[model samples]
Target: MALSCGIDFGTSNSSVAIVKDGTVGLVPVEGDHVTTPSAIFFQRPNNTVYFGREAVQMFFDRAGGRFMRSLKRVLGTPLMTQGTLVNTRHMQFGKIIAAFLQNLKTQTDVFAQHDVLNVVMGRPVHFVDNDAEADRRAQEELKAIAQSVGFRNVEFQFEPIAAAFAHEVNIQGEKLAIVADLGGGTSDFTVIRLSNRYLRKADRAADILASTGVRIGGNDFDKDLSLSIIMPEIGYRSTYGEKHLEVPLHTFHQLAEWSKVNFTYTPKVIMQTRQILHQSHDRKRYKRLLQVLEQETGHTLLGAAEQAKISLTGQAEHRAAFGFIEDDFFVNIQRREFDDAIQYEVDKITASATQCLNQASVRREDIDLVILTGGTTEVPLVQEEFRRMFPKAAIADENKLSSVGLGLAYDSQNKFGDGQP
Candidate 1:
């Protein structure tokens, strides 16, 4: 017999799900964890590769190696075609992605003895935001990668719609559901008509009303927070000239951003920073920035920023200590500060949700249920925004992390039933 499963290749994490014994179940991707961090760590000395949690640990523990996360964000961009040096070996980003998915296939094969070929891959509503051509190309790139990794019959499903299908499984009555899938790189929203009556249908095209997405998510919040709270200590807004000319900000922005961190490690950027520091009025902060670059602690700094962002979601205040840059170097961040930093992203997400409803010709009150998925939805402000938008609707977060994968599994079952080997 052949096995068909759902793959949610998220920006920050990844998961696989399948319908086993007539029930949708999450298949552990790494060490009994259904959702695994989307990270790849290469050990230079042994030329070994690690995935998920082990990969993250290797990244933090190893001395010199390449650690890549947020790989999905490179899709449809020029970076996808560019190769990078990992352990002195040149590897294309596409091949790295394929290797990761192939590893996922190997892991799935361990517990699932069947020859798995059919797959339903979850994707954001708009991979490249408003650019339809780029978005289409992104899907094509992913499909090619899936095919290269042994998935023979590949199908695509909107991530938000997949989450909605997961929620629809237990819903008894009819509902006009809005799914908010806030992943690491994108925020997607979908309005759908679902019910026990529609659950039995083979296709759900008619049930889906509108889908909208934007290139704003958890990473944006992390970047904004880093710029606001962390960058100032390292000369982000400091002066350089007799006229009090502000220091250049492009390099600092790149340093604060996760995807751009690697790009900032080049010789050109280092030289530019040195030139700025030599003439900087705020020499202390620029020296700190120079040390950060020399130490290659960009990932560590971004990690601190991400932790602070996560901490602020539940608590009023959080302190991020950057001992890697300087002993006793730290910054205290509050929830309000976080909110202020990420207000632009949150506002865009809200606007996207409103656009989804408007596109569906539905009123906010008409939305009977709001289903939240993806890890970023854990943020308190996002939750409050949903509540404010649909005060009457019941907000559901039952499948916050696994909804897309589970829904894709449900979709796979509906589409392939028992797939052919």
Candidate 2:
């Protein structure tokens, strides 16, 4: 028997799903966890690779090696073709991504007794916002990568549209839905009519009214929050030298950004941070920054920021611990501060959602349903934006983290379930 699955290679987390018989189901990518963090950690000595939670855990445990997350954000950028050091060996970003996907396939093969091949990968509406050429290249590169990983038949569906299909699984009648997939790397929106009547139809192009996305998501929020709160503590935008001029900000930006953290571990960056530490007004802050650079704890620092952002979703305040950066030193981040920090990103996401509806020429009131997908939607501010737009629409967050993968599986069933594998 042949096994086909849908791969949602997300920025913050990833999932794999398959359609067995007529029912769509999720694959346990991480020891029974349907979803796994999109992270990779390379252990030292042998440079063996680990994925998902284990990867994150190994990195945090100071298990000597390289750690990387948010690899999906590199697609469509020149960095996709660039090489970086994974331990002592240099590896291209594309290969790192392929290793991750290959792991997904290997795990699937284990589940299916070594019978898996065809795949439908879920992608954002726009991988590189505002640049058609880069976006096209991104999909091309991804397709090639997927094929390299033993996916004999590969296809793609816009993530928001995929979320719509997942929502359609338990829906009734007809609904004019605005599917908002606020993921880690990007936030995508689609205005589409969802109905059980069209489930069997292979072509949903007619039902898709509009699709639009912005290159902003949970990771961006993490960056903003880190810059606003955490980075400043670690000498970001701090003054140095005789003129009291602010220190160069290039290093700090990369340090706080989840995708760019590992890039800051170069020898050049370490020396640069050391030079900045020399003229520091307050040696303590830059001192820690230098330590972070030298110790290669940039990822851990950014993870603290990401955790702080997630904690703010359910609580009014969170203490962003930086004990790794220092001894028992942490910052109290209030919800209001987080909201203020990420206001710009939230506004841009809202604008994109409105733009999607405009591209469809559909009035906001007509969207009777708002299907929310991806972990970013759990944020209070992000959710509030969609609610403000579609006040009357029913908001559904069924399986926010796994909807895209599950929907892609349904899509695969339609596209590949013709009679034979």
Cα-based lDDT for every prediction:
0.87, 0.89
User: Per-residue lDDT of 163-236 in model 1, one digit per residue for the tens?
Assistant: 98888867887889999999999999999998867765897888999999998888888899999988998888
Candidate 2, poorest ten consecutive residues by summed lDDT:
412-421
Stretches > 4 Å off in candidate 1: 419-421
Clash pairs detected, candidate 1: none
With a 3 Å backbone cut-off (N, CA, C), the pairs that clash in candidate 2 are none
Report the lDDT tens digits of candidate 2 across residue range 1-421. Answer: 3667899999999999986666678889999898999999989988899999999999889999988998998998989877788888989998999999999988877776656778899999999988999999999999999999888889999999999988896778889999999999999999999998888788888999999999999999999999998888888888999999898898889987787887887898888778878889989998999989888888888888889988999999998888877898989999999999999999999999989989999999999999999999999998888888889999999899999998999898898882133
- Candidate 1 local distance difference test against the native: 0.87
User: What would the TM-scores of all predictions be?
Assistant: 0.97, 0.97
Give model 2 RMSD, 1 decimal: 1.3
Distance from true position, residue 89, model 1, in Å? Answer: 2.5
Model 1 earns a TM-score of 0.97
Model 1: per-residue Cα lDDT at residue 329: 85
lDDT of model 2, residue 300 = 82
lDDT of 1 at 12: 88
